[model samples]
Target: MIGVLTSSMAIVSAGGLLFALGEPFIYQVTVMPFIALAIGVDDVYVMLGAWQDTRRTLAPEKRMALALEEAG
Candidate 1:
């Protein structure tokens, strides 16, 4: 999804910038961004699934709250 990609890109860009700014390009730094992105993507999928599982009869705001509660 666009949201996931946008967030992932932002995270990667920030990490890359920090690495370029004299931070050591250690293995953890090199791989952690991707690991974080994967976790983020998984979280999005879980949140979306929770949202979809919410009752259709509920109001949008209530549904969102329920989804968030479930996701959290």
Candidate 2:
């Protein structure tokens, strides 16, 4: 969570810098992909964090049971 929060703040700062640099709007459009890529990874990081927390909370053998129970 700490790393995720720091990474997200860093990403926001970098994106803000890119927007503030006055690059051509058209050319700057290309940067959206990189920012999006970073955000995508950030999402994965959050998901893995949740997974780790869940795994730590429950026994490995209980995970499937928990998952199935949650699905219902």
Candidate 3:
């Protein structure tokens, strides 16, 4: 959730900066959000699935690290 929100904000900020600089986008601006959304949702699912597969006996931090590694 946090990652998705942060990425969305970063993309928006970059787009705004490009507009300010009068730089043209190669793709349509409207399509970017949908593409980002699809990618974010896919990533979230991958992370969640990885977390679920991690060992329950491990420490929380360790489990998270394992999940991230598996997800990656």
Q: Report the number of the highest-lDDT candidate.
A: 3
lDDT of 3 at 44: 89
lDDT values for all models: 0.84, 0.62, 0.86
Candidate 1 residue-wise lDDT at 9: 89
54, model 3: CA deviation in Å? 0.5
Candidate 3 per-residue C-alpha lDDT over 4-67 given as tens digits, one digit per residue, 9 for 90 to 100: 7866987788789999999976765778877886788788899999999999999999999999
Q: Write the per-residue lDDT of candidate 1 for residues 1-72, one digit (tens) a residue.
A: 865686678887887788789776666566766777778888889989999999999999999999999999
Per-residue lDDT over 1-72 for candidate 2, one digit per residue giving the tens place of the 0 to 100 score: 554565667767776786799655566565765666677677666555555545656777676565544433
Compared with the true structure, the alpha-carbon lDDT of candidate 3 equals: 0.86
In candidate 2, what residue range of length 10 has the lowest lDDT sum?
63-72
